[model samples]
Target: MNALLIGAVLISFSSVMVVLAGLPPEVTGFYRLTGGGMAMLLVLARAGKLKLFTPNTIKWGCVAAVFFAGDFVFWHRSIAFVGPGLSTMLGNFQVIPLAVVSALFFKERMPARMYAAILLALGGLYLMVGVSWSGFSADYRLGVSYGLVTACFYALYMLSLKYALSKDRVDALVLASAAALVSGLILGGLALAEGQSFVIPTLKSLAAISALAFICHAVGWFLVTRGIQTVRGALVGLLLLLQPTLSFLWDILFFGKPVNPVELSGVGLALIGIYIGSYTKRKKRTQ
Candidate 1:
């Protein structure tokens, strides 16, 4: 049930990202996050769950801003370089680091059997790219680099948010809202420095980014936080594997992406990993 909900959220973002692929990176960055942040903020404010912004809240929130900003900028750039499917797969690798850090620092643990899941997930990502490594052209190379960077930044965002959520430092909704505003301002500056237009984004692009924010950032994070409180750390990590899976499906239907044998096998491996990680952990917990 929890897994299904996460998968549904993943599918929503997958479709949204396909739409966002056509927008300017900076514009895409702001719209993809800010609306959802505002929505969450509104709920928090009305509920009086909105905590006062503290120095520490500002610190972590600002860091989240930078990471969120960096993640989108580089991810959008990666899509421009590599195709969406490959970029999404690589960016999704942040799950590996998240699982590891949660185990080390947050005491999120699973049984020995869970190790196999990581390998399967990585294998899936490798296969998703066809594992050819042949066409490492300047664009592809740069895209890969940026994709990995996006993963790193995303991992940081996850960790920071996890800390904030655990501490109840501020309302999650408030934190999200402030982070988006900060990130929007930062990206707005970068767009200015790059001579990109910031005034009016296209209607199509606005719609795409609106879906990205409301569905992806706001809903995804909201449910993930709630789900994580109930599920195991490894299970939570594995559940997110849905994002890349559904994102690839969107690439095929929307962008005319065709899966080769290698790619299919790779995606299979990723799904297997998720099953191994999540199911095995669940069984261990039961035992």
Candidate 2:
């Protein structure tokens, strides 16, 4: 039930992020993340759950900041090269890398049935993005590259979080605050260096971005961290599928983007794979 709730929240957050992709990715990432983190900080302070930063918390937070920085940098560039839809789908392919990273570094294991499910999920991923192959050679190649970088860096971030959680029982808000500070300073500098002007957002965009900050960056990321504390990295990778699937839905409903047979088939397979993966694992635990 917790997993399902986390999945639902992640899907909603993914929809929000895709919409915000129109903004300069770096500046938008900074504001959305920093604002959201700040809001949580306030909540933590009010509740007196916020913890003081020891060397350990700060150390883990900074490591996570590196991967976070990489994800924003690369994934945003992916959106610029590929259209938002394909960019999103491809960027999400990082689940493969994440699972590998977990298995290798963290020795994270899963039931054999769940491992089979992972392969099916990857095959589904291929189908999901393969539809855009028509007249999409150059852009597709670049998008795949950017997306792969995003995935690899994300794995690093996931592993770092796992390490941090293993070390201490810090508040989610505290870790978020630390990450926001480090990520913001690094990415903010890059944005300035690139001359990506931080223009004032229009009313609509501001409202949208604010929702993004609170719902996606803050709440969504927090849930992700929470899930990582209990679930293995491979499982977290499967769950990240929520991002693209939800983004696809948003495109359909809000943007009026139509889907065809190929896309639907791909989505169907991916959903089935996720179901299979989760079920296989759950069945084992119950046994």
Candidate 3:
């Protein structure tokens, strides 16, 4: 639980780091992945856990990498389009798709409370982004679209990761490190193809990127993966919500993104809805 709390808070700084770095989307993703991957690799080597990568681990790690790649590309683009808060919130919308998948494939029961929660989340989104979506500039709309796309890929990544963790017996560090390295390679190629430089020109940008890699990616993900293994699914969702919620607040505090009453209300509704949707009553033990 402490791991989840700390990890969520740490990762919530991701958008702020990206904003501070002020680099191209792919560039930021590249450095984040590669640098964090290397850091994790070193940690694994030091701990002598580098031998834990099995065939199953590699396969699932590759799968996670692909989905993460898509997520990073679209999510960073969305961040460029909209501010961090809204973009992060939009990405966290993965819960909607994930729930639908659960119902369809896993045969999970969706009660009325869950349904209401979904509607609330959607209503909140409508207030935040949908209401003015058409009236907004082309870039903004495009950002919103990318954000939704991000949610899809993020759902896929979560599914793959959860499966990998449950079935593969792979250490979380091994999976995370390998996936980050692979995704970094993919993004690195894309960055080069798009003519983006790998150079960090300013020390400030370097510091931000370093913090992003070591703090947010390496430490944050390690703690999160550990916590997710122990925490219940619904509770995990509620705890992880801290990431976007704090991220939105950070955007307001740091980025000076303008927020109106309608938008604030929307955020509240969406957050409440998400919590309600994810809440599950514990069943009493049978004698």
Predicted structure 3, TM vs. truth: 0.90
Off by over 4 Å in 1: 1-7, 14-21, 99-114, 167-170, 223-239, 274-287
Which 10-residue span in candidate 2 carries the lowest summed lDDT?
278-287
Candidate 2: tens digits of C-alpha lDDT, residues 111-142: 67657767876777667665576656786577
User: How many angstroms is residue 11 displaced in model 2 relative to the true structure, after the best TM-score fit?
Assistant: 5.6
TM-score for candidate 2, residues paired by index: 0.79
* Model 2: how far residue 40 lies from native, Å: 1.7
After superposition on all C-alphas, the RMSD of every candidate to the true structure, in Å, is 4.1, 4.3, 2.7
Task: Give the local distance difference test score of model 1.
Answer: 0.71
Give the per-residue lDDT digits (tens) of candidate 1, residues 98-137.
6777788889875665677788887877776537667557
Q: How many residue pairs clash in each candidate?
A: 0, 0, 0
Q: Which model scores highest in lDDT?
A: 3
Ranking by lDDT: 3, 1, 2
lDDT-better candidate, 1 vs 2: 1
